[model samples]
Target: MLGIDCPKPKGRWPTAPFDPRFPKQNQTRNCYQNLLDYRPCVKRMRRRGKSTQPCEYYFRVFHALCPMSWVQRWTEIKDGTFAGKI
Candidate 1:
């Protein structure tokens, strides 16, 4: 299941250089697009008996690549806690 609250950026966050070979290259797009890319892996995981765990892992990946604010909104929507416009 998704978490209710957004992830808070911790101290001493180091900026990493961008790499084109990263699997989640288009993660900077809107939530809808992000969901599109994530859904396939999620389905495959479920078919392999992973259940919702894979979805949670996707959320973690999104949180890691996206800004804290974006992660908060995404988490809210994923957890059914967001009811406003995106």
Candidate 2:
């Protein structure tokens, strides 16, 4: 979410403008926050009816916004041992 909402997410790609109401998505904070927002989306999608038929917009933005390896490091960095230390 993070102030950026995807277009109904047809198939090829997802595009959303940086929300002028808040910090831009290109920033690290907003990008990671977007990923966090997506954490709930997966479950909601399953409960409401999954959309596994196609790649969802959250993941598309995740890859577009940051590298996969960075995600691994983010997981490690978010662990209790590293929390608030960064």
| Candidate 1 Cα outliers beyond 4 Å, as residue runs | 1-27, 30-36, 51-61, 78-86
Cα RMSD for candidate 2?
A: 8.0
lDDT of 2 at 57: 52
What tens-digit string does per-residue lDDT give for candidate 2 at 1-86? 22223335355655444645346545566556556656457556656787733335555665566666975565554334433321
Per-candidate alpha-carbon RMSD to the true structure: 7.1, 8.0
Report lDDT per candidate.
0.50, 0.52
List model 1 lDDT by residue over 1-86, tens digit each.
34323235455544434445454746465434444446556656656877555465444455556777865455445543444322
Where model 2 places Cα greater than 4 Å from the true spot, the runs are: 1-16, 21-26, 52-55, 73-86
TM-score (all chains, Cα) for each model: 0.35, 0.49
Q: Residue 2, candidate 1: how far off, in angstroms?
A: 6.6
Query: Model 1 has how many clashing residue pairs?
Result: 0
> Model 2: which ten-residue window has the lowest total lDDT?
77-86
